[model samples]
Structures are given as C-alpha cells and as structure tokens.
Target: MNFLGFFNITTVALALMFIGSIGMLVVKKPIDKVILYSIVDAGFLLAVVTFKYLDVAFAIAILGPVSTIIFLMSILKIDRIRHNNREGGPNV
Candidate 1:
C-alpha cells in the first residue's frame, strides 16, 4: 500500500482512539473504561502495523494484553471488596 494511504488510515485510527479516550473519561465502571482504553491501544497497534513499524507494534502487542490483565485483576479485587461490604452496608 502507498505511504499516503497508510498515513490517512493512521489518522483515522488515531482519531478513533482520541474519541475513545474521551469516552473512557466519563464511563462509570472501571472495567468498561479499561476495555475502551484497550480498544484505543489496539487502534494504535493497528496504526503501527499499517505504517510498517513492526518493532513498535510488537511492543504494543505485548504490553496491551498485560495491561488488560492487570486491569481485570484490579476489577476482580474491587468486586471482592464490594461483595464483602454488601453483607451489612450499601451496594457498590
């Protein structure tokens, strides 16, 4: 593909990521925001791959899921805390 086409596509992908980040700021749930942030990371990966930046793409591919897993573990911990608190107090 032409570099020009790649540049255009990258612009679109980055725009989507920007919008997704804005959405995440207002999202109420931790898990939902994490998921949306992950999508934005995936969009960056897509742009890197499209631009033939394999090294950057590889790093993003490795780091993205690791972050997602960390976020998921945090969410699980939160749920556990909420469950523990729910026996005699307000819901989380």
Candidate 2:
C-alpha cells in the first residue's frame, strides 16, 4: 500500500532469497541445504499470503519440496550404495 510497506516486502524477499542461496551454495552438507531451501519456500509462501495470493501460496506449500525430497532421497541412496561397496567405505 505505502512505499514503506513495499520496501519492507522487498527487503524480506531479498533477505530470504539471499539466505537461501547462501545455504544452498555455501553449505557443504546436503541436509542443511534442503532445510534452508524449505525455509526459503516457506518464506515465499508467507510473502504470497501477505499479497493475498492464497491459492498460489497453497500450491507452493503442497508442491515446493516434493521433487527436492525425491532428489535428496536419491542422492542419499546413491551414497549408501557407494558406501556399502566392498572397498571398506563409510556407511550411511
């Protein structure tokens, strides 16, 4: 509504995005990145709700992490398989 309100929205959105990117890029651990990404998605959902985009927010809430979890699961599984090899690697 007001300039300050819009500025607040922008600042929040930017901060969330920046935090997400930092987590995704700077963190060496995959689990931490996934958690941060979920946080970022929740932040986005909050932003959308603030703008009265309830439908979009709901869609994001329902669908945002499905693929991410699937991918993470796959990666973990692959890591497990590799570690389970007979070469005496560390197990997951």
The backbone clash count of each candidate, in order, is 0, 0
What Cα-based lDDT does every candidate model obtain? 0.83, 0.77
lDDT tens digits, residue span 1-92, model 1: 56776557777788868877987988988878887887788778878898999998898888889988888888888887888797766654
At residue 83, what lDDT does model 1 achieve? 86
Worst 10 residues of 2 by lDDT: 1-10
For model 2, state the Cα shift of residue 13 in Å.
Answer: 2.9
Q: Cα RMSD (Å) between model 1 and the true structure?
A: 4.5
Candidate achieving the largest TM-score: 1
TM-score of each: 0.70, 0.66
Task: Report how far off residue 14 is in candidate 2 (Å).
Answer: 2.4
For candidate 2, the per-residue lDDT at 58 reads: 85
Candidate 2 ranges beyond 4 A from true positions: 1-7, 84-92
Quick one: how many clashes does candidate 2 have?
Answer: 0
Checking candidate 2 for backbone clashes, the offending pairs are none
